[model samples]
Target: MANRFLSDLDPTTAWAKAAVDGKLFTCGELVRHAAECHLRDIRHGERRDRATPQRTSDNMQWIVNAVRSRTNCAGKILIEGASFSSSRNWVSNGQAAAFDRLYGPAGNIAFSPHSYYDADASGTDASCVAGAQNRLDPPLSWAAVGDREIFIGEQAGSGLDAVCQFVLPAAYAKLRDHPNCIGWTRWGGARRRGSTYAYRLDPSNYQTGEDTPQMKLLLRFLAQNP
Candidate 1:
């Protein structure tokens, strides 16, 4: 409607006249145009991420910093903040630093450096081993975060022992024994690989009323670490 209306007038002068010529415009047209622009601005604001990046990052930083300090967790607590989530538009450096100070003081907060293992990249296990020793431990690039309680949070396998066996024992120990490492986290919840939803490890699903082999492993680690 706006394009059609503007097309009938002198292209050059019509726009300029719209700014000053009350004679060429009606009150209804002016109100409707204002409403259009107002709606446009409103929609533009809505298109932004669920929250502003800085705001989300700020919240993330707070959550990261509080990992060690959360009183709700009564035992030795370790957190695995994934290396700067690109999809989430958060940088790794900032996230890494949030725990840097914490590690020095309390040694409870730590981040999981991405090896791209679960990301289906080539030779991820090798990458995980290297990161565990190099960056995930003390004297990493951010030297402030030295020898702290580091956790490798992954429930190995692609939801099956067969899948996890390929990476277990072989690559698992290197990650567990890496310098400064304290424990592990199994991402054994719900995961998708190819067309199948990887096995769900809700514990209750087991007929023996016991943990699956994977749960047994994680539980053993917790028992030993705590």
Candidate 2:
């Protein structure tokens, strides 16, 4: 609708006018506009990752700094993708150290590392071997700097075995004491179905199943500790 309405006018002028008018816009529209504009610019420019190098770098840095600023100011921050350093380098250099140094008063920060515990357990290597042991600990890792609480946002949640269940109690017990280190939260909260290696509430129907019982259990554990 917005695109069609602006079709009769200059696209650039229309966008600027809409911004100046303070027109109500949804987040989805903003993302759509950004993606379309970026894609178009890419198509028109040199076909390279560094196409529009300065503008692209500045935009990305602006986003990263804004998020980092917010995280530094907040009491709790949830992080992911640090473990898989291979895919898309999520954490920036010195960012972790900045978080650690800045939040040194009450230890109010948490770092959640991602892992597939079951897969690691089945592995025969040394590194994978240790991960198999850490699986004995809660999959989530929370780090407190000063009074700040930091927690990992996701954890392995597939192929349940006795060892996997065993790690929860001690991890939650420690988290309970911090008064800020809340219990580990499930990534998807068991929403998917037929996710044999993924986290889901109902693995039975693989479509519609009540994972309420499992969620209720998690809630109870958090309430007792938090």
Candidate 3:
């Protein structure tokens, strides 16, 4: 879930109401339901509004409390400290403190950030900018300050020759060198035959199971890093 807005999770909101009607959650029961279901990790919010830091922090605290209160659930929670587009201002703007108050001492919580190498870092474009790997520097500095662990929840470039040969290797190297960054998951793995996503990892045919260029690159990186 992108979970882009506070209203996205607000039960009173029309969309959220529709979600509830579909049995997504009862009011005040989103976290509880996840806990009861024993999810391994719950990313409560992602790239929330930078203007509403307090409400975002409060929402996260609510999730932390819900998880902590449940002895039967051992799942961890993941947080994104800044906007999906950039983490550049997060630490300096006191956003880290708001989250630290709730998440700092909790061992079961970690920072999860989505990263992309495209010009806008939106993962919508197949073309990548030169030296896009440097985008991780800001988030890396933020994680270092709190001695926090990081999991790159989403990352990918297209299967284009230039992207696979240059963009991905540098990005993978950056993540590998950063000890705080635990690992990363590649985006766009749809198995549908007609899917048009740029970064898909699935093979063209299920039976043949031929690896895409992106998957082959990923496999090579995994072997080298592992």
The prediction achieving the highest lDDT against the true structure is 3
Tens-digit lDDT track of model 1 for 45-145: 32543223343344445554454344454345434332222211113435445444333224344544332234332222322222222223222333223
Model 3: per-residue Cα lDDT at residue 195: 49
- Candidate 3, residue 50: the lDDT equals 28
Native-referenced Cα lDDT, model 3 = 0.65
The order by descending lDDT is 3, 1, 2
Candidate 2 lDDT, 54-160, residue by residue in tens: 34433334434444554555444343322231111113322233234332233333444443334433221112122343442232222332343434344433324
Model 2: which ten-residue window has the lowest total lDDT?
81-90
- Candidate 1 — which residues are off by over 4 angstroms? 1-77, 82-107, 112-116, 120-145, 159-164, 190-196, 202-226
Clashing pairs in 3: none
- Identify the runs in model 2 with alpha carbons over 4 angstroms from their true place: 1-81, 84-95, 101-116, 119-142, 188-198, 206-226
Return the TM-score for each candidate structure: 0.40, 0.42, 0.73
**Which of candidates 2 and 3 is the stronger one according to lDDT?**
3
TM-score of 2: 0.42
